[model samples]
Target: MNEFELIQNIFKASVMANTQGRKDILLGIGDDCAQVQVPQGQSLVFSMDTLVEGRHFPFDADPVDIGYRAVATCVSDLAAMGAKPAFFTLGLTIPKSDPQWLAGLAQGMAELAEPIGLTLLGGDTTKGPLTLTLQVHGYVEVRQTPLRSNAKVGDDVYVTGLLGDAAAAVPIVTGEVLVSNERLDYFYDRYWRPTPRLIVGMALKRVVNAMMDISDGLAQDIQHILKASNVGARLEADRVPISAELRQWQPESALSLALTGGDDYELCFTASKEQASEIQLITQTLSLPCTKVGEVASEGFSIEGYDGDISGWQHF
Candidate 1:
């Protein structure tokens, strides 16, 4: 298919990509450029992420997972800033115009977009090796958005949801792991389809002193917070949450994954001691597992009981 045909047929024509009659979108696909309206009294939040075959995922990974993951990761950034998902544009490159793959990608993205009320704005398509880039835009109350640098000393460090499942899934995806069962399926799904903590982040924005999502890994990602806030941290290794499935699948390696494994897509935040009860109430009310793992300190970073080798995910 030609470029225009691919855009109209695979993307613009898909029900998932078109948000019919959306008042906020002045123009979407089929236009020279997409246009949108920022709501009054709200600040716009935007993030872009690129995924390349072999670098970001296995070359033969499911196309649907690829589509879903691209959007999910972009929205995760919005969640970190405590913003609502609004609209997104896609820049997709493929070696050839494959209808089956495009259909699968559209289906996967639509399933995710429909639930979150995300509208596909517009973007570019090119003939090249497979790579996907998505730019997500959202909004939050003016001047209330959280940042990684806002962590304060005396703040209790917390994380929403378990960690390390996605990191462990890497070996499975690469065929390095021999195990197969519920544990394998769970990890595989976690890596492919991460649950962005949007609601939890939006709820905790006004309450937390600092906030960020766990994309690179707990140890490395948390350093961004510490350096930005100009403070240190001492995390209780025992308090770090690990899933039972991961523990059973990798008894010796699970702890390290939970600590340094990337791709959890969960939110890590800090609040003062006085707000601990309120934090608990918020998580409990939402039925989301929020764990207190450490506190912001005035010195250097340390995770008690973990002194072994662990590093963050790096493109280099």
Candidate 2:
């Protein structure tokens, strides 16, 4: 089909299904330029991410999972900022317009975005390598949104959910490893369908002094908070949470993956020790595990219980 036909039949239809209650979206698909109404007393927040074939996903990966991941990972930025998801615009580049593949992608995007009430505002489609760029928009209270630059010394560092699973799944995704069906499913979900931790993030906005998502492994990502806030950290290496699935599969490397492996999409945040109880209460209400992995320090960064080179996903 042609570009207009492809969008009208597939992408536009997907947007319509997800845009029902999105009053914030003034003008969505079919417009020359989409318009949105930012909530009063709140600031607009946005982030864009690009996923390319072979780099972001395997060439043989299912388009459904790819689409879902494109939305989930990008929306993680909103969660990191403690923002409520609003709408997104997509920029699609493909070598060819395959109707079936495009349909699966649309279906997958809707599956994840519908429940969250995130709608597609608008975007562009072009011919090129297989790549997808999603720019997510959200809203946060002007003064309440947490930032990386606000962490303070003596604040406790915490992360939501277990880590290392997605990093471990990389090998499997690349056909470099094989495992049982159950384990395969777990790792695949971890890699391809990460939860954005939005509820936890919004709840912790007041509780945490600083907040950011762990896209590039805890070791590398935590340092970002430190640098941005002009502080140092002392991480209890053993405290970094690792999934049972990953520990059982790679006991020797589980810790490393938790520390240096990327794509976990979990939130790494900091809060005053006095707020520990409140943090616990909030996470408990959500039934999500939030673990204390470290504490802010006066000067330099260090990881207790292990001495190794600290590195993460290198985009370069």
Candidate 3:
């Protein structure tokens, strides 16, 4: 089928199925530009992520997994800023229109978007190498949204959820390593379907001084906050959270992965010392593990005990 037909039969149908109960999206698919009404006393926050085949995912990756993860990883930006997810637009390019693939991709995205209250507003489909660019829109309270540049000296540093699993999964997904079924399942799930920590972000919004999602490795991603906030950090290497599965799989490499591996999607943030008890209470209420890895320093970044490279995922 042609591009327009494919969008109507596959993508538009997916949008209709997933966007139910969303009143914020005033105009959606089939428009030249989608429209939404901004809520009072709130600001619009959006981010775009581009995922290329083979580079971002396995060439043979399932379309559904790709779709789900595309949304998950992109919406993670919103979560970092303590924004509530609202709408997203897709920009899909493929060499050919495969009905089944399109359907799976759409289904995968819809599943993730539904629970998070994200609606499909609009997008473009074109013929080319397989690439998906998703732009997600969220709303945040004006002046209340935490920023990467807001970190202050003496602020406690924290990260939500375990790190390094997604990085470890790369070798397994690419068939470069052999692993047990348990290991395979755990790592695969971590890579393909990471939870976007939206609730945690919202809960910590008022508490955190500076925040950003770990897209690149902590070694690299944390630098952005440090530079932006004009502060430095000294992370305790042992404090970085590693999953039991990863430690069991590769004890020696687990620390490296947790330190320098990418795609964790967990929040790496800083908060004042006074908010420590409240942060603990929030994490307990949410039943999510939030680890205090270090504290913001006056100058210079250092991770004690890890004397290796910190080059995270580089697009170049």
Candidate 4:
């Protein structure tokens, strides 16, 4: 089939199949640029992420998982900003049209979108090496959006849920580790499907001074908060939560992996000492486990067991 016909048959149908409640989408597919309307008194918070085969995921990875991860990662950004997810646009580049692959991908994306009230508005398809990009939009009350720069020196550092499982899962997913079926499934799910802490972020909006989702390890993500807030931190190694699965595998490296390895997608936030009691109450109400791992400081970032040095993921 020709390129245009291929897109019409595969891409166009894929776009139309996922139905979401998006009244403001004035124009969607078949337009040069999709148009959307923003309601008054609400500010838009948008983010985009690109995932390339081999770099972001294994070349042989399931297309469905790839699609789910692409959407989840981008939506996590919205969650960090304490925004209500609205809609999204996708940009897919592939070498050829594959109906089975596209169907699986659409199914995965629909699974995530349906749960979170997100709608797929529009996107473009092109011929290239496999790549997926998602641009997500969300809404926040005017002047009420959280930012990374708002953290204060005396604020307590916190993270939701356990860490390190996703990092530890990598080797197993790539077949570097031979684990039992149960352990294998656990690790694979942790790596492939991350639950973005959207509800927690929304509830903690006014309470959290600064917040971010841990995409590139706790240590590295915290650095972004530190730099933006013009402060340092002292993270306690023992206080950082590590999963039982991760602890069982490499107890010695548990702290290191939790602090340095990536793909946790949990919220790292800061609240004042006075707000600690309230923070506890909120977490309990939401049933989301949160830990006070450290406190923001004046000078530089340091982890308790790391001898006053910070060791985390480095892209370079």
Candidate 5:
């Protein structure tokens, strides 16, 4: 099918599903450009992510997972900044015009976008080696914008939800190792469909002094905050929040995955000591496990009881 027909048949549902009563989006998909209105006194936040086939995912992975992950990863950035998800545009590079694949991809995008109140703002489709690039937009109150460079010395560092599940799924996805169906399913879901902590991020806007998502492993990602904030940290090995699934399935690699595994997508944030109680309340309210893994200090980054590779994922 042609591009126009493909969009009409498959992408229309993604565009129209969230159309009712959406005043923020003045125009979406099929228009020359998407028009949006940033709420009064709120700043617009936007982020983009591109996933390449062989480099980012297994060569023959599910198209539906690709579609969902493309959106989720980009939205993860907005969540870090405590912004409410808005709309997104997609840039697709495909090797062929496969109708079934396109339909599944569109379905994947709609399912994730609809519940989050995200809209399709139209984008470009090109012929290439099967890549997906998504640009997501969000809105946040000016006074509450979370930044990576605001960690105060002595602030407690925290992470939302379990870590390392996605990284643990790499071997399974690439067929490097074998595991039970239940374990495979759990890690695979974490790998392909990461939950963006937008709710906790929004709630953290008033609490956290510094914040970021753990896409490139907690170890390496934490350094970004330390450098930006001009502070160091002492991560407690015992305190890192890890998934039971990871420990149960791969006991030996569990800690490594939790410490340095990329693609966790969980929030890594720092907040003042006085705000600890409030932070606990926020996580409890959202029912997400928030753990204090470290404390911000004047200089130096090190983890107690661990002297291994802490660098997270890097393309090179």
Candidate 6:
């Protein structure tokens, strides 16, 4: 199909699916740009992420997984700010019009959006190297938005859920791992479909002094918080959680991956020692697992139980 036809068929349909029940959406697809209404007394939070084939995923990766990951990555940003997802726009660039590929991609994105209450408002389509960009917007109560700069010395650093599974799954997705079907499925799912800690973020609002999602590995993400808060940390390497799947493969490597491999969309935040009981109670009520991995300090960042300097994923 030609570019215009592809837009009318696949792009339009996806937009329609995304904008359904979105009362705040004033304008959607088939327009120069989409429009939305921002309610008063609420602050709008926006984040965008782009995924390119080969660079972000395998060249022959499943489109559905690609779509889901693209949206989840952006939603994670909202979660970090303790905001409720409102709507999103998708920009897709592809070399050709492939109906099957587009359908899978739309389905993947819709699956995540349906449960998260995210509406796809609008986006643009073009011919180029295959890439998917999602811009998500959320809202938080006035003056209640979580920031990474609020952490104070003596605050307890906490993380939710297991880490490093996504990074471990990367090799499985790229055919680097030779394992049983069960193990392969475990890793592949972790890498492709990550659960953003939206509920945790929302519940921690006002309680957490600083927060961010662990996308670029825990070590690196923690540094972001430390720098913003103008404080250092002493992370207990033994306190980092590693999944059973990862442990089975290489017990020693699990900690390294969990700390430095990246791609885990878990929530990491700082709360005062006085707030620890309250945070624990909240996690129990929500049925989410959380662990105190470190303590905020007035000095430099360092991790216990590991030799030399701390290491994590680097974009460069």
lDDT of candidate 3 at residue 49, scale 0 to 100 = 97
* lDDT (Cα, tens digit) per residue for candidate 1, span 168-253: 99988878886768667787789999988889888999899999999989988999999999999999988999998888878998
Model 3 C-alpha lDDT per residue in residues 41-77, reported as the tens digit of each score: 8899999999999999988899899999999999999
In order of TM-score, best first, we have 2, 3, 5, 1, 6, 4
| Candidate 2 lDDT by residue in tens digits, 1-316 | 7676766578777854667666677776776888788878889999999999999889978989999999999999999999998888899998888888899999899988888878877788888999999999889999999999999999999999999999999988887998899989999899999999999999999889999999999999999999999999999989999988888999999999999998999999999999999999999999999999989998799999978778899997
lDDT, model 1, position 17:
55
- Residue 131 displacement in candidate 4 (angstroms): 1.1
* Winner of 1 and 5 under lDDT: 5
Candidate 6 differs from the real structure by a C-alpha RMSD in angstroms, to one decimal, of 1.6
lDDT per model vs. reference: 0.86, 0.90, 0.90, 0.85, 0.88, 0.86
lDDT for residue 4 in candidate 5, whole number 0-100 = 60
Clashes of each: 0, 0, 0, 0, 0, 1
What are the models' TM-scores? 0.96, 0.98, 0.97, 0.94, 0.97, 0.96
Candidate 4 regions off by >4 Å? 1-21, 307-309
Candidate 5 vs. true structure, TM-score: 0.97
Error of 1 at 219 (Å): 0.4
Instruction: Output the better candidate (3/5) by lDDT.
Output: 3
For candidate 6, lDDT tens digit of each residue in 189-308?
A: 998999988998999987999999998888889998899888999999999888878999878778888988888899999999999989999899989999999999997988899663
Worst 10 residues of 2 by lDDT: 15-24
